[model samples]
Target: MKSKVIQKIKLTKDPISNFDLVIQAQKGVDAEMAFEISETLLMPDEDLSLILHLSTKTLKNYQKSEKSLNPIASEQVLKLNELRKKGEQVFGSVEAFNNWLKKPAIGLDDAIPYQFLQTSGGMDLVMEELDSIAYGDFS
Candidate 1:
């Protein structure tokens, strides 16, 4: 009889599966991953602080210590990654999506989408708006 060693592999592909995201969230998101997300999204520390509900001082400490974000923050980070993908798909490019985020949208009550990235409910509303645009229901 041969003994088999089963190794768990973390998913590193784009658009990670929901199950994998849940697991990753539970384990917490590392500083490197947070940095990657910020870089990819062109988000400044001030914006990130709002999303994570953490003070700028704490965020700096986390960076200095190479800490992992808590589960709630980790989950928010993962969701933001998904939102980035969806935004890119809808607008045809990251640049276009980012431009859209900066401008006020009529459907979003003339509010800039970037301002809504702070909370889960606001993120969902943005996602809904994206879906509406993608589906040609711009009204």
Candidate 2:
């Protein structure tokens, strides 16, 4: 029974957002897979930092929160709203917003750093695929 449970857990994918960050940070998931996943989860003009921060918060809550309806969920939602406000303040003008959008998806080497990629065995596969795509191996 224990082995069966473990196997089921192993087969399950980690939350899609974590996979996105691992690929983005490592520059290593397959382009198609990454693009598809990103498209599904992110709006075309979404701020990478905003999505990343939200994903990080969501993943943290999923792992640690008592349940979906816990106070932590509300707190995270509030924090995200606060972050959006800060983003607007920092990138007040349309030009600033455009420039920010044009910037590389992963600005800092540690923006969506390696430490966050250590979720499980599957992450390495995600990294490998991302690396290949970044190198134009897909074509």
Candidate 3:
């Protein structure tokens, strides 16, 4: 197994609004930014590739070349970042949120939330679950 060595880059000191993320997504997400998001969410290349509809080899190639992903993938990256923030808020910590992600959620038809992250629709469902949790609605 290849070890991941994350070299963190400064994203922004100020909070990024949804409008800013939309603009950034339109501009494209570069390899470094994607990697940063992966690190933030504790996701390995394999998982991120699945969510981005890319292969691990391609993700490595992009990292090697510092290539920027197209708009759609870029948007996915930003959405993941946003989800990470919301999850932390809902779960009280990133570690807790990550743990929750790996388990089956009754609200999601007993599917692991991590698996749901692979598609936009599934991501929306995961987000809704988080919202429900935040609002104290466990059912």
lDDT of each: 0.76, 0.32, 0.76
TM-score, per-candidate, Cα-based: 0.80, 0.26, 0.81
- Over 16-135, each residue of candidate 3 has an lDDT whose tens digit, in order, gives 676766677676777666777788778998888989898888877888887878777877887787778788888888898888999888888888999988888787799899889888
**Model 2 stretches with alpha carbons more than 4 Å out:** 1-69, 93-107, 110-139
For model 3, where is the 10-residue window of minimal lDDT? 1-10
User: lDDT by residue for model 1 over 1-139, one digit each (tens)?
Assistant: 0001001222233567779777878877765566567777889988888898987788778878878788888887777877888888888887888889889998999999889999988888898999899999662
Best by TM-score: 3
lDDT of 2 by residue, 1-139 (tens): 4324323322334322444333333422222222223343232413322333435344444435422322322222222222223333444643443343334334233133223222333234334433443455431
Off by over 4 Å in 1: 1-14, 17-19
Query: Stretches of candidate 3 above 4 Å error?
Result: 1-19
Candidate 3 Cα deviation (angstroms), residue 83: 0.8
Question: How far in Å is the alpha carbon of 134 misplaced in model 3?
Answer: 0.7
